[model samples]
Target: MYIGIPKEIKNHEYRVGLTPASAHELVAHGHKVFVETHAGEGIGFSDDDYRAAGVEVLATADEVFEKAEMIVKVKEPQAIERARLKPHHTLFTYLHLAPDAEQTHDLIKSGATCIAYETVTDTKGGLPLLAPMSAVAGRMSIQAGAHSLEKAKGGRAVLMGGVPGVEPAKVVVIGGGVVGENAAEMAVGMGAEVVILDRNLDVLRRLAKRFDNRLKTVYSTSKALADHVASADLVVGAVLLPGAAAPKLITRELISTMKKGAVIVDVAIDQGGCAETSKATTHAEPTYIVDGIVHYCVANMPGAVARTSTMALNNATLPYALALADKGTKKALEEDKHLLNGLNVCKGRITCEDVSVALDLPYVPAEDMIKEL
Candidate 1:
């Protein structure tokens, strides 16, 4: 099998799909790995580093995409990269297709087998592949929100961890999953007044025990959410619905009622955001004011911490990637139901029920699709 690693081309994205160590592992398995020139340069992995690991360095992304059977990437393919995709290629990456109709349509037209890292599952029903980046984004949400809360950034000029003479800012996390848990942990560590809202009682209970009364855990309700949002100085939208679009829990009307100059860090922006006013922003210009509320909705929040994110992601993705390379996509996915869940598109057919429903496309079960292939 020939695997390719292309430099990420998203705005301010610096993470490479395969680290030098990861390439070495593939090389050890007797697989040929082609890395785009300087793909890992942003993260301190030089072309010599890749060569030491037995990877061939290609001069252009076009060559890597053209020669490799499988294209490994950190982010979704941009328009040009998508155009380069061929029917024989397998794209293994974080394809957030539920929210982006254009990308989904292009992918369908490409006729390539696309496996989304975000949709892969574990035996315990957690998104194993998406966890690392989610954790990174969750922790960074507080950091970004704190910066956005400065007066110069159109915020209330409130400090997250207030001084002895002043009260701390109130932080409301809208979910109790990985993102919400990490966000709450960071906010509480920073001495903020933190409240977590979730509909799942078990999740809320677990969080309450984890925080040990340091933060408040409220049963999520319309009234409860409204009350929390009204008092919150920073609201972190951490809700998710797997491969589906994130529910708009915080509406435009809700934002209008928020405190003047409040900040909202939408960690769920990659899945179309949990707030009505949220739009994907880039690190170049990460915030914008909406109804007097500041929104930090950078879609690739983990990209800002590329080195850490790349290594962490490689830890999660390497095993599955090897499986695909070793056994081939159809055989590997057919053997592992969890990996099969990652299959969004195969042979131009949408195989993920969530993505199909979200995009109003026809659905084909991964099991059924693979058998036909």
Candidate 2:
């Protein structure tokens, strides 16, 4: 099997799909790895490093895409990259297709087998591949929100961890999953008044125990959410619905009534955001004001910390990548039920039920598609 790694071309996105160590592991297993020139340069992995790991360095993304059987990437393929995809190619990456109709249509037209990292599952029903980046984005939410809360950034001149003479800012995290937990952890560590809201009682209970009363855990209700948002200095939108679009929990009307200079860090922006006013921003210009509320909705939050994000992502995705390379895509996915869940599109068919429903496309079960092969 020939595997390809392409340099990410998203705005300010520098995370590479495969680290040198990861490529070395695949090389050791007798798989040929091809990487675009300087793919890992942003993360301190030089071409020499890849060569030392026995990877072939291609000068252009076109060559890598042309020669490799499986294409590994950190982010979704941009328009040009998607155009390079062939029917024989297997794209293994974070394809957030539920929200982006253009990308979805392109992937379908490409007729390539697309496996989304965000949709992969574990035995315990957690998104193993998505968890690493989610944790990174969750922790960074507080850091970004804190910066956005500065007076110069159109936020209330409030410090997250207030001085002895001042009260700390109130932080409301609207979810109790990986993102919300990490966001609340950071906010509490910074001495902010942290509160987490979730509709799941089990999740809320677990979070309550995890935080040990350091933060408040409230059952998510219309009234409760409204009350929390009304007083929150910073709100972290961390909700998710797997491969579906994130629910708009914060409406425009509610946002209009929030504090004049409040900040909203929408970690769920990759899945179309949990706020009505949220739009994907880039690191170059990360915040914008709507109704006098500052919004930090960078779709690729983890890309800002590319080195750490690449290594952490490799830790989770390498095993699966090996499975696909060693056994072939159809055989590998047929063998592992969890990995099969990652199949979003295969052979021009939408294989993820949630994604199909979200996009109003025809649903084709991964098993059904694989069996036909």
Model 2 weakest 10-residue run by lDDT: 364-373
Give per-residue CA lDDT, model 2, range 1-373, as digits (tens). Answer: 9999999999999999999999999999999999999998988999999999999999999999999999999999999999999999999999999999999999999999999999999999999999999999999999999999999999999999999999999999999999999999999999999999999999998998988999999999999999999899999999999999999999999998899999999999999999999999999999999999999999999999999999999999999999999999989998999999999998899999988999999998898988755
TM-score of each: 0.99, 0.99
User: Between which residue pairs do clashes occur in model 2?
Assistant: none
Candidate 1 lDDT score relative to the true structure = 0.95
lDDT of 1 by residue, 59-162 (tens): 99999999999999999999999999998999999999999999999998999999999999999999999999999999999999999999999999999999
lDDT of all the models against the reference? 0.95, 0.95
Off by over 4 Å in 2: none
Error of 1 at 190 (Å): 0.4
In candidate 1, where is summed lDDT lowest over 10 consecutive residues?
364-373
